[model samples]
Target chain A: MASTDTFTDIRGCPSGARPLHRPRRRVPREPPASSFPTRSGDFGTGARTRTGTGARLRNPAERARRQWAVSGWAGLSVVCRPGVGGMAQSRGMTSIKATSGGESAVRVRGLVKHYGSTKALDGVDLDVRQGTVLGVLGPNGAGKTTLVRVLSTLVQPDAGTAMVAGYDVLTQPRQLRRVIGLTGQYASVDEKLSGRENLYMIGRLLDLSRKDARRRAEEMLERFSLTEAAKRPAAQYSGGMRRRLDLAASMVGHPAVLYLDEPTTGLDPRTRNEVWREVRRMVGDGSTVLLTTQYMEEAEQLADELTVVDRGRVIAEGRVDELKARIGGRTLRIRPTDGHRPAEMAEALAASPVTGVGGATADVEDGTVTVPIVDDDQLTAVVRLLAERGFGIAEIGTSLPSLDEVFLAVTGQKASVPQDPRPAADNSDDLEGAAV
Target chain B: MSTATITPPAAVRGARSEGRIGLRANLRHISALVRRNALQIKQDPESMFDALLMPIIFTLLFVYVFGGAISGKGHQAAYVNYVVPGLMAMMGMNIAQAVGTGINDDFKKGVMDRFRTMPIARSSVLIAKIVVEIGRMLVATAILLGMGFALGMTVHTDVLHLLAAVVLSLVFGASLMWIFILLGLTMKTAQSVQGVAMLVLMPLQFGSSIFAPTTTMPGWLQSFTDVNPLSNLADASRALVNGGAVAHSVWMTLAWAIGITAVTAPLAVMRFRKKA
Candidate 1:
C-alpha cells in the first residue's frame, strides 16, 4: 500500500519555488533547509525577514529545514553565488532521489536501431536506479516507443546493449521477461474473454496452476476495483478499466522491474491521476519502474529522474528543477512605479549580468522596464540597484521555468518537422538567441 | 478485501520463472490455450453457426440438387457415397484455412504480441490454434457422416478402412494448414486471408474430382487433378470408405503431406521469428 505522504509531497510544484535572494549575503545564526516542507518562501537565510504576517513572520527557512529532514528523500540545498559582475544570484536546486541503492533496475548504453532508411534509435543511453521511476519524455515519432521496445526485449537493437533486471536484453531476453513486466501503449488483454478469465490466462501462462491462477485473478480484480465487472468481457469495459486490467495483468507475476509505454495517453485527467497513484504505490513498495510518457506534468509529479529524448537521441537529462534551472532560469518581470529615462533603467541593469546577455532582454517602454533573469541573485541585485536609483517598484513577480521552456532551451525548437533548408538555418540562429 | 495483493505462489516462486517446465508443462500450456480458444468459438454465434449448420446444409444441398443430375436416376445412393468422402476432405481444408484467418486477425489485433511478451513457449499460440481447428474439423466431419447415414448411404468398406480414411483426411488437412499459415502471416487482414484462401484453395477443390471423377474431366483439368493435394485427399477417402484400390492414392497423399510441411512450415516460422 502507498503512503499518503508521498502523494502530498509529489504535489510540490509543476515548477518549483522561486529562490529568494538577499543581497547582503549574511549567514543567519541557524542554518535553514535542513528540516520539513516549507510553503511560505525559499529556504533563504533571513531573506523573508519582514513584510509577512504573524505566523509567517517566524523563520520560514527553519520550517523548510524541518520538513526536508523529516521527508528523508528530497535534498533541498540553497547555494547563493556572485557572478563575475559582482551580482549575487540565490538559486535552490531541489532534486528528489529515491531511497533505494545498489544494482540498477535498468541500464543501457549506446543502443542503436534502424529500420530501412529510418533511424528509430541512434546511440541512446539511460540508467534507472533500483526502486525508482525514470520518466522517458519525448514527442510523437521521437523514438520514445522504439527505445522502450528495445529495452523491454521486444525488438533487438542493431548495436550496443541493454540490461534489464540484471539480464542482457539481446542474449537473455527469456530471463529478462521473467523478471520484467511490460504494458504497451495499447491494452493487450483479451476482448472476448471476461476480465477474470484474461487475468487467469496470463497467470497460467506465467506457470501458475488453475487454483492459484483463479485466486490471484480474484485478488487483482478486487484490488483494481473491478470485482463487479470481473465476469464481463473486456470489450464492454471502458478505456480506463481496460488500462487498469492491462496494468493488473503485468503485476500478476510480481515483476521486479516494470515497463509502461505511454501508460495514460488516452485517459482523462481523473483516470490519469488514478494511474499515477497506482504507480506511486508500486514505487513505494520498492518495485523499479521505467515509464515513457509525453506529459510534462506527469513526469514532474512522479519521476525522480527524467530523460528528455528528441530525434532518436537524448537532448537533456537530470532532476526536474535541475533541467529547469539549466535552461535560462525563471523570468523576473519588474514594472517601475515612477517614470524614468530608458537610459537610466538600462544603465542600472547594465552593472549586473542582465545587460542583454545570456538571453535576458531589457525592454524600457513608457517609464517601465522588464528584464529576464537567469539567476536568483540577479533578481536580488536588480531589486537592490533599482531601490538605490530611487525607482519605485510597481509590480514584481518571478515566473518559474516550465518543462516546455526547458525542452525549448535544450532542443532549440519544438517537435515540428520542417522541410525548408534555408529557413531552418535561419530559425536555428533565432533559436540560439531564444535559448539561454 | 484487506490488502490481498498479488503474491507469486510458492509453487512458482521456488522455480525459475522462465525455465523450461518440461513436456508436461508445455502440454498443459498448450491445452489451456486450446481450451480458451474453444471457449471463444463456443461463445461466438458466428463460429457456432459455421460449425453446426454449414456442414448439414452443404451435405443436403449437394446430395439432393447435384446428385440426380450427376449420378442420373436411381443412382443417388452411389453419388451420396462418393460425395460424402469428397465433402469431408473439402470441409477440413476450408476450416483449416479459417483458422489461418483467425491467426491473421489476432496478429492485427495485438493478441499475438501479448502472447509473445509472456514467459511461455512461443509455439503454444500456433499449436493451440491448430488443435482447435482440427477439433472443429472432426465435429463437422462427424455430422456430415451422420447425415450421410441418415440418407441411407452406408460405408462399403470395413471399420478399419473407415478409420484410416478419417485419420488420413485429418493428416492431409493439417498439412494444407501450413500453406494458409504462411498466407496468414503474409496477408494484412482476415478479409485478405479469405480472399486468398478462396483464390487458392477453391480452384484446387473444384477443378479436381471432388464433385465428379477426374477421368471424365477435360484434358487440361485432368493434369491439375493429377497433382493437386486436394485431389489426393479426396481419392484416398473414396478408396477407404467406398472400397477401391487405396495403396497408390495413400502414398501420393502422404508425399503431399511431407512436401507441404517441408516447404511451408519453415517459411511461416521464419516469418514469425523475424518479426521478433
Candidate 2:
C-alpha cells in the first residue's frame, strides 16, 4: 500500500520507466516516515496472521488469538498509518469545550500546511490546558515541528487558525509573541557572545530596563547553572550547557505559554534530565507548555497528557497509562526453570485455566512465554496454572504496557532509536553519558 | 481548575506596562538595536577587515591603474579628485549589501524568529540595519577619502558642502537599503543575496560616471547612465567637493533618493511581514 502510493510519480513521469532503474533520489535511505517491512500477514492462507520477529501464526487458535490485535476498529497495525481516513477537517474552538471541557492555553483548529506535494500538516487539531504539558509525539516528518512553528508565530499556516495564550496567531501575533516563548530544535543564540551576554541581549530585546536586564541576566545564569561558565563564549559550552542556556534564554521573559520543540533531542541523559527539571519548575510557576518529542520515555516523564501524532494527525491521546490500556492490556512474562516454554497451548489449555480470560493471548519466544492478560485476576489464574501444569517457573513478572509498546501498537512502525542520532560525537560532548 | 493571576517575570512585566510607546521610547529601542548590531560587528574582526580593506583596495586599483589613462598619462591628482566621489558611492552600495546578507543570515539561523517574538517596535530592526549601513559607509568613506587626500585629491568647497556631500551619500545609501531589505527577505539563501548584489549593483556602480564622464561613453550606454541613481549620487558629490556647478545633480539625487524610498520602503516591509 505504501509503495503503490508512489507508483505514478516514478513510472508515469515524463521521463518514463528509465527513472525507475536509477536509484530513487528522494526516497529516504533510512526507511523514513511510514515504512514497516515485517508488519503484514499472509493473505493466501485463509487464517490471518501477523509476521514479525518471534511471531508464529501457524495454528488456527494461535491465528485467532493474534486476530485480536487486528483492529476491531480501523486495525492499521501492520501497514497504514492511523488518521489517514478518520482525520476531521475542522474542530473549531467549540471542540475545545467538548473534548477537554475547559479553556485551553493553546488551541489549534484544522491547521493545514503543505510543502510542495507533501502535506507536512493536515488538519491537525489539539488543545493544551493551562499549566499543563501536552506532549506531541510523532515520527520523522510528522508535522511536529510545523505545529510548534505555527503556535510560536514563527511560520504562518496556509489554512486554519491557531490561538496561543488567548491571542490568534494570525491577527494578534504581536500580542501572542508577548505571551509565549519558543525554544526550537536548534539553539539560536549568538555564538560570538558569552552566555551572560546572550541572556542580556534577549532581555534588552524584550524591552527590559538596563537595571532589570542586567539583573535578569544574572538571575538566568544562576537558574541554568551557567554561572561558572557565564563569562565564556556559548560556542565553547558543552551541548548540555548550551541547551540549558537556550531554555534559560526563553524563560527570561516569563512567557505564559512556552513551546519546546524536541528540547532534549541531542542531549545526554543527565542533561536531558536537567532540561526536564527546568520544565517542571516552569510548570510550577504556572506556565503552560507544548512539548514535542520523539522519545516516549521523555513524554511519559514530562507530559500530563500525550497526543500521539503520525503523518500530521493525532492518532491517540491520553495519559500514558490510559493510552497503554487502550492499545493493549498489561503483559505477563514467565520463564520456566527447565529452560523451555510449554510448546503447545493444548497441554496448558485443557488441563489449566489459562484460556479463561476472553482476550488473553500468549506468545512464547526464547523459553519465555509472554501473555497479554486483561486484568489482575486473570494474571493470577495464569500464574497458578503455569506452575500447576508442571511448567517449572524460574522467573515470574508482570510487565505493564510501556509507552514504547503503545507507540508501536498505534503507529505500526518501530520507534526509531533515540540515542546517538548522529554518528560523529563532535558537537555534543555527553552522548556517551546519556543514561535515562 | 480555577486560578488567580500568574506572576510574570521582570521582562514580560515591562512589555505589559507599555500601552503605547512615545517617540522617545521608540527611539530608545531603535538605538538599542543599533548598539547590539555594533557590538556584533565589533566582535567579528572579519567584518571590520572587509569594511576597512575593500574600499582601500578598490580606490588604489582605480586611482593607480586608471588614473593615468583617464587623465593624460601619469596625471594622478586630476583622476584622484575625479574618482573619489564614485568610490564613495560604491562604498555606500557595498555597505547596503552587508545589510542584505546580514539579514539573510539572521533568517537562516532562526535568529529573526527570536526577534519577531519580542515586544519591541517592529520597525526597529529595519531602522537599525539602515543606521548600521550608514555607519559603515561613513567609516569606509573616511578611509577612502584619507587615501584620496594622500594622493592629492583636493576639496574645493567649504566644510559645509563637504558635510552635505556626506549627508547626500547617506540618503542614497538609505534608499538602497530599503531595496536591499526586500531582496534579503525575498531570497532564501545568503548566496542568493550576493548573486543579486552582483546583478543589480555591479552595473549601477561601474556603468555610471564614476571613472569617466557621460560624454566619454557610447550613445546607447549614455542613455541608461543618465538616469542611473548612482550616477546622480556620484555627480552630486563631485560637484560639491571638486567645485563644479551643483544645482542639476543635487536635485536629481534628492529626487531619486525620495522616489526609490517611497516605492521600496512599504514593499520591503510588506515582504518582511510575509516572511516573518
Candidate 3:
C-alpha cells in the first residue's frame, strides 16, 4: 500500500501533545457567510509563502527552517527549496548523475518516431541508472509503449538514438537484443504451447543448449510459481497465470535490462502485488527495469524515479516524492463532529495567525476543512485553535497529495480512468504506433 | 507467492556477453520454433482441419463426381489416375495458403514481437512456419494418394517415379509457401490474407489442367495454364505417375519453383524486417 503520510514527524508525533477536541453540542448548518473569502485569503498568503520568492526574502531564516522540516524526506530536500532555477538545476544534476555514472543501463536521446502523421515519440529523451526501476508514467496514447518498443529493438525508430545495456538500439540491435528482455502489454506467449514449452523455446532461441534450456525452464517455472501449471497450455491459463508465464519467459535469458510495458495494467490487486514482488526480486538480482504504467500507485510503489509523459513529451521527471512535492506539500483535513458546520470551523481557523494564513477552506460536501500546511507547527496550531473554540473534531489527518492529484496539477487534465471505455481508440493508436 | 530462492541459470549467465547468433544457433532456433509449431498443432488439432480434411473431401469429390464426364462415361478408373496426381497440386496450393493465414494469426497474437526481440535469426521464425506447413502438405498428399490407391488409381510407372512425383510436389509446395508467407508478412489481417489467397488460388486451380486437360480449353485460357506454376506441377506429377512425356512439364515446374522462390523469399524477408 502507498503510504499517505509524506511528513515523517507529523505521522510519528505524540497524540497527547495535540489533544483531541470532542464536540459538546450540535451546531445548526448555516449558509456560508460572506466572511469566507477573507478567511480563504489569509490562509492563501501563508500557502504562497513557500512558492513566492518575495515572501522568502522577507524572512531569511524562514528558508532555513522550512528546509529542516523537509530535509528528512527522501528526494524532497533540494526540490522543496523555493526557487524555479534552483529546483531545475537540482533536477538536472540528478539526471546528470543518472546518465553520466558508469552504471547507466539505458540512455535515449531525441528518439523521434512518426507513424504516418502522428509523432509517437517526438524528441523523447531518457536515462535509467543500473539496477533501478525507471517508471515511464503516462496515460494511453502517450507513447510510453512506443519508447519501450524502440528501446527493445522490436520497432525501429525513424530518427534519434537509444542505447540499452551499452549497445545502440539501431546500430547494435542484434547485440542489444542479447542483453535486454521485453514483456509487452499483451502477454505475448504461444497460447497453444504449455507454460514450460514457452519458456524452453525462448531459452533455446537465446542460444541455450537443449539440456540447459530445459533446466532453465524448470527453474523459471518454480521461481514464478508456475510449476503446477507447467504442462498446461497457456491458452487454458487464467489472465494472471498467463501474465506470469509471459513474465517468466522474458526472464529466461536473465537479461541485464527488462522492459515491462504495463505489466499489471488489468490485473487484480493480489496479482498486481505478486507482480510487484517479482519485479523487486528481479531488481534484487541486479537487473535494471524500465516499467511503464498508468497507475500512479504502481509507480510510487516500485519506481526509483518517474518520467511522466503526455502527448509524446516528458512533462515532469523526478523521484515520486519530488514530483508530489513539486505540486505542494501535505494537506491537513479536519472533519467536524456530526451537525457541527465545517464553515464555522474554517471561519475560526481563518482568523487565527497560524491556521488562518495556511489557505484553510471548507468543503461542504465532505464536511471538512482542508488546510495546506508547510510545517508540523501549522497542524498543531489548528488543533489548539479548534480545542480553544470548543469545536468538535470528528477526524484529523495530514496527507501528502496523492499522485493522482500531482498528475492533474502537472498535466492540467485528469488522467484517464483505468477502466475507461475509450480503450478501443487508444489501443488502435498503440497498434498503429507498434505496427509501423 | 513465496520467495523461491533461485540462482540464475548457467546458460543465462553465460549468454550475457554473447554476440549475434551464429549459423549453428540460427539452425537451432529454427528447429526449436519448428517444434513449437508442431506442439501447437498437436495441442490444437483444429488447426490441422484444412490439411487433414481438405485432401480427403477433394479427392473423393473430384474422383467420383467429375471422373465419369472428364475421363469418358465408361472409363472412370482412368480419371482416378489422372485426377489424383493433379489433386496433389491442388493440395499444395490450398495448404500453402494456410501458411499465410497461420503467419498472419501469429502476427496478431503479438508473439512475433517476442521473436523479434530475441537474439535469433529473424528468418528462423518464417522458415519454421514454412517447414511445418510443408509437413502438413506432405500429410495431405499421403491422404490424397491413399484415397487414390483405394479407388483403383494405379501408378503406371515404377515406384521410383511415383516417389519422384511426390518429392516434386513437396518442392513445389514448399516454394509456393514463400509467396503466401510474403502475403502473411504484408497483409493487415488473417481474413484479408485468406480472402486474397482464395482469389489467387481459384484461377490457379480451375484454369490449370488439374481437373480437365488444358488442350480442350479456349486459346487464352490455355496460355494461362501453360504458364501457371500449379499447372506445371500437375502436368509433371501426372507424367511421372501415369507414364507420359515428362521433360517439358518437369523442367518447367522446377524453373517456376526456382523463379517464385527467388523473387519472393527476399521480399518476404525484407517485409518481415520492416513489418514492426
Model 3: which docking level applies?
A: acceptable
Predicted model with the maximum lDDT? 3
Q: Chain A of candidate 2 scores what in TM-score?
A: 0.64
Candidate 3, residue A330: lDDT: 55
Candidate 3: residue pairs that collide: A43-A357, A43-A359
Write model 1 residue lDDT over B126-171, tens digit each, in one string: 7888888888888888888888888877889888998898888888
Clashes in model 2: which pairs?
A: A269-A434
Ranking by DockQ: 3, 1, 2
Error of 2 at A345 (Å): 14
How well is each residue in A11-115 modelled by candidate 1, as lDDT tens digits? 222212212111222112122433322322321211111111111213344334324333443232432111110111122221222222235679888888898
lDDT, each prediction: 0.68, 0.68, 0.74
Which residue ranges in model 3 land beyond 4 Å of their true spot?
Answer: A2-89, A92-102, A333-350, A355-357, A361-369, A375-398, A414-436, B1-18
Under CAPRI classification, how is model 1 graded?
A: acceptable
Total backbone collisions for each predicted model? 14, 1, 2
lDDT (Cα) of model 1: 0.68
Position B218, candidate 3: lDDT: 92
Q: Which has the greatest TM-score?
A: 3
Candidate 3: global Cα-lDDT?
Answer: 0.74
| Recovered fraction of real interface contacts per model | 0.36, 0.36, 0.68
